[model samples]
Target chain A: MDNQTISPRQFMFLVILFSVGSSILIVPTPLAANAKQDAWISISISVAIGLLLVVLYNHIATLMKGQTFVQATIAVFGNWFGRVLLFFYLSFLYILASLVLRNIGDFMTTQIIPETPLQFTHILFLIVVIWGAYLGLEAIGRSSEMFMPWVVLLVFFFTITLSPQIKMENLQPVLGNGIVPVVDTSTFVIGTPLLEMVTFLMIIPYVKDGKTKKRAWILGTFIGGAILTLITLLCILILGSDLTALNTYPSYKLAQKINIAGFLEGLEIIIAIIWMITIFFKMVVLYYSTTVGIAQFLTMEDHRPLLLPLGMGMVVLSIIAYPDVAYFETFINETWFPFAITHGLIIPLIVWIGLLFKSKKQNKTQQEPS
Target chain B: MWSMISIIVLALGIFLLEFPKLYKKNRKKEAWFFTIFLLSFTIISVLESLEVELPNPLDLIQTFYKMIGF
Candidate 1:
């Protein structure tokens, strides 16, 4: 009878697809550049952070039982304060959604459809987001379910196809630049993408198998991180750390580099399709989540009606928000990690701690019978 | 501007589509807030599409990050 229940396997699929979305496209190169061939080291460090977030998300979810993170906020903060906190959360989510849309739009223009107007792809992407949202959470869930196999299959193909080009010599003297740069890059690498799991709190309460949620989140993150680590490792081997960081889509480039005795060339186009599909799933998740969050914040029963305009708005916002790719690059490097941490990590931690104390106090009160 | 026409169309379309769901006595205050919130996004989207000058609130914030060197 519980409508909100989502199986752990389904949740895992969502996590993997969602986790790989934008991060896979842009993160590998710079992270490799930053830490040299030891980029996987940074990924490992970031993945540890992902594990921490699993604990945090599970802690909050278990406390709230079957309610979403939004409901839990009210439980923690009461109506007025909870509502206010929710507004902030909603705003952050909205920004994240818009940023993702922008990133995907820019990526599209640069790579996939250079001649097509950015607005066209951005708007089309948002249309998919609206369609997903309008069809309801169940549609979003099912779509992720359907996309999971393709996403996973393509990832393996992408990795294996690039195998011939991989040069073990490229990985010589791993951590060649000393641990300092690795550590510095680790903060962003681990902090930004892995740190993003804090948003899972929003989905936590809606997750069934509450006891197994921690396991689901941890395993899911590890699976996603493993894919990323493999990709980064391959990127280093194929392109060398120097060349890897120069290209925007290193994995795509890796696919392009494949010739396989002239049997398989221009695999990058195929990889781009896979990348776009996974990215769309991720964007839709974020967009649906933001709409749901805002609807709940504003006390709306259905977020469906708001989806179209929000999607439309996001496409436009994507263009205006950053001056160009360089500015966008700078914002991500210099700006995003910290903001992501505060909103995605620290604030959620505060919510968890608040819930913990409140639960403890409630337990005490119940025991005392006062 | 063309953006104005687009914004009006979007806002009007949303108001029409959502009015039935939105204008109910059983509705929560948040429903009203979300409706308006969404409507405002339409305006923001239109102005942004038109390439209107909007404040970059993150400049100072980003500058600090650059200075700190992350």
Candidate 2:
């Protein structure tokens, strides 16, 4: 594969965008349902844990020494076993890309344009995602840099406009339940956009400068988690835990609550725009990783050729990803956390352990030869 | 029927757009890989357009996790 490098700054922006991704819209609902008024605390705890996860990912990247995650697996595990393990990893990445695509389709169809067929939305969004993937990581990174300011500004305005609606009573009885629920909710939070940072292992090696790569990864995650926490806190404060938990898209509803003296009523489109931009980057990152993973797996020269076909496949997979919204919710609440942990934590931990053994063996051989 | 036709046309369009470049470069391996992926995805798209009851991979994951009591 030819070299494509993105500066650590651009890498940071991508991390921030990807971390914020679809979580901004949907995370509040589950968090509020589980943790009630303490949902923000749940997110805060997850952010701290997420930082530690980033450190683990950085250690894996340091060991990789410029190899993509796909290549690293093969180097660490030998060809056949690595490829077997990689098949599972690649499937997870591919399914995740489709799932993200399906999310856009689901949101747009249900919320914005109810009349549009879900497949049409998927195809339309997939076209842009495919284009971004074909342009490669450098392009994806540059675009994230360009779009980061708008995301930040929209999120800031979103929080500021809705501040007046916040009821202190909404957050009363902070620990009314217990710490267990808070910790439990935090695990769910960690499962999502946090653990999914494993995908960044594919892109981290492409980032120039080792120290900045680590710094950018952690900083980007911090900012992203902060944005999510603020949004979740706003959801609880403005809409109250019950309504926030009940609604599928509380953050969007929070945006709609921005009346601004009755003149600015329907700025929910701001939420839509923010979600579109952030999810677009998120899907692009996931789609890029899937394509690159497949290309590297097959030992192909360029990943570009696989983009269009996979894009089509993703549309179909997404359509069938969840039969309905209820199933999606159940999958998220129950299955997603363990599944994510397996791929995001356990497998990488095994790879890290393998690296240690390999280094130790190399040291022993060198000493014996001397 | 129209959905099926559209799916096929879309696949063919992608093929036309990408195949020549791969062919020109004589990257035979990539060309073959692309053809296989395009063919398989095209077939799946057709099946999906037909509303065939294809199995969902996520069900398998859920089942496996449930079996393991996670």
Candidate 3:
């Protein structure tokens, strides 16, 4: 745990790893299902949604003027109510950890090791998260920093490998059914993976130089968003609209299709490993944030004690939140709209807006009589 | 069964690792809320995972993809 301040580039790399990890592998399959060949609309729409949330988060970050979410919560809302709102934030984080871990667990059983018991993989993932947290923020930061290049490079390779199989014509008719479906799917786009960027605020204050903080976070986010859009387009081009919809891991299938003189067959497993690695980092980041934020918000001296209960809680919640794969993905697509928007969009906006007024009033007073 | 025991034991060990900070005054409600929420969250996720049914969005997705041959 080197207390050395993080450069902006390191944080940006963390964002790239966090953003591309989960969204790249399987996000397009669901988006393709929702948007048809029109899944491109979902990614584009989610991009707007992601950016909108980023703007909200940025506004809150700016209003706090370098305060972490913990410090800002108390400053803007006062001690008690701030704590209440933070509880909600924590709950949202818990749900997020649950969902991501559960998704990872599902993927592991389905793709990585089919015979291994689901519970075993689930618990094993938790062990990594818990152990990782024990090592502290620097560990997560350093690991994300280290692994990001390989993750990004592997993704480009996957996308390029499927380049030939991608039938550009499969994406035709360009909004043929009209704006209604595209916009509807776009909301689905917003609700699913992209809006989760609200968690980035937790990491904002930790940026070593306050000057380049915004640029670093946005760099990470936009880069991640770009990767998502490209993968969605690639999946649509490769799998058409139907089978892409049918398969749970359509992006993996596209990578599998990259056969170079028949020797490159089954390379999508490489992509799946990429998915697993990147998502691992994403979960670690979110889980780490949850523990650290709670510890800080509660005024604890350290966050190490909270990791296990949090991990166990996530596993429990992931199982409880969605009944089956269809419902799991469904919860992600539809039901999560209000849930995500409330936490991801609505609450953050309120906190930021409220804090903005608070700062202005204080600034005005500071200039007046003193 | 053995794995579940390990998870619970590991979780408890992890919780105990932070025992010194648990007594701090500022973090009580937070500790309470987190403990309750985590417990509740886990129970619900485990129970829900056992139940079976497709959410409507998935069916719609499948149908739409099929209609478009996508």
Candidate 4:
């Protein structure tokens, strides 16, 4: 909105970081619980579904080039209804940012710093998120480029170092529980993490090149989804299905299991830092989208005026959102799936269809005039 | 007591950081909105610090999930 655009490469890295975000630590356990040894299958299915979603979002972006998702929604839906949809979109993104903030807070307080109050972690983290966003998307994009290599290297290190613990026996009897569980877990994967790429609809317009934009979305989704799949597979192979399912942060547990000589025993710190860095990128991107989306919805010329206040709102709402991680996980499993479908899939599909009709009508009008 | 103090201090810091830019740009409406937003958070923090019960929005969502048999 400020005439700032991120390069396609930065967009790709952002996608990779955002998709990996908390999922590295959060997704493995749930997938393990549902799909057991076949959790990787769930991830693969979600990746396929996620790629299609990227295509759908790219199609919509092509239809409404040179506009943020909010502007494009208004263009298609007209004023009042469009305004309503904009509010819905804003709520979706804001809730997402708040939930992610809550997640980092939960992770830190429960796992990393048990003595520290959750509020402290939320506030401390939001400070950076607000600052990164205040510098604008370019700064965020550039920062992601700076951090991506280190994050990737750390992940690879964890994976290779933990290779000794991976037992082929852990993946025995493939599809032992039948496809139901895999499908069920894949639904969770699709609804929660993958379809959450819908937020990128708000982001893709900022890519400077059209060709680069298309490739970035498609390639980024697959690469990101692939990373998640690998992580899930690693968790299953190393920790076994029961331990993977039992531990809340199975990937973190896998990190803990990296006992390559006694010297490298406690490497969860690297995993924590990796999660923090990726989550920071994800939260900032979502927070920036919410602020810009709201400012546009309100017809404000500058979004800066709203950044800090909305950040305050994010911190407070995060506190108000979940009583504890257990409830939070339950909400994800039960409520989040349908909610994601409505916002992520159904809403965007409706808008795209509306755009199609609008384009056809305009073409007909031009033909009649000619 | 500590939480309340911290909330006030944080709110003040936010005001200090952001208010000048708004004042410099003559953005009165934005200034008021920011102040109000900070004030509301302060109140919530104070209430939370005092251990007063407050309804959480996420609970409402959970209730909706139950109502839908989810």
**Per-candidate RMSD vs. true structure?**
2.5, 1.2, 5.7, 1.9
DockQ of 3: 0.17
* lDDT by residue (tens digit), candidate 2, A1-370: 5588999999999999998889987799999998999999999999999999999999988888788989988988999989988898889898888888888788898899999999989888988888888888889889988999999999889888888877999998988998999998999889989999999988988899988889999999999999999989999999999999999999888888898887979999999999999999999999898889999999998899999998888888999989999999999899999999999998889888877787778789999989
DockQ of each: 0.48, 0.92, 0.17, 0.52
Tell me how far the alpha carbon of residue A132 in candidate 2 is from the true structure, in angstroms, after superposition. 0.8
Which residue runs does candidate 3 get wrong by more than 4 Å?
A: A1-4, B1-12, B15-70
Against the hidden true structure, what lDDT does model 2 obtain? 0.91
Residue A361, candidate 2: how far off, in angstroms?
Answer: 3.2
Candidate 2: misplaced stretches above 4 Å? A364-370
How much is A286 displaced in model 3, in angstroms? 0.7
Interface root-mean-square deviation of model 1 in angstroms is 2.9
Residue A129, candidate 4: how far off, in angstroms?
A: 0.7
Docking class of 2: high
Native contacts retained per candidate?
A: 0.51, 0.89, 0.22, 0.49
Off by more than 4 A, model 1: B24-31, B60-70
Higher-TM-score candidate among 2 and 4?
2
Real A-B contacts recovered, model 3? 0.22
Cα-based lDDT for every prediction: 0.75, 0.91, 0.73, 0.85
- Tell me the tens digit of each residue's lDDT in model 1 across A166-226: 7899888977778888878877766556766656666666666766767877888889888
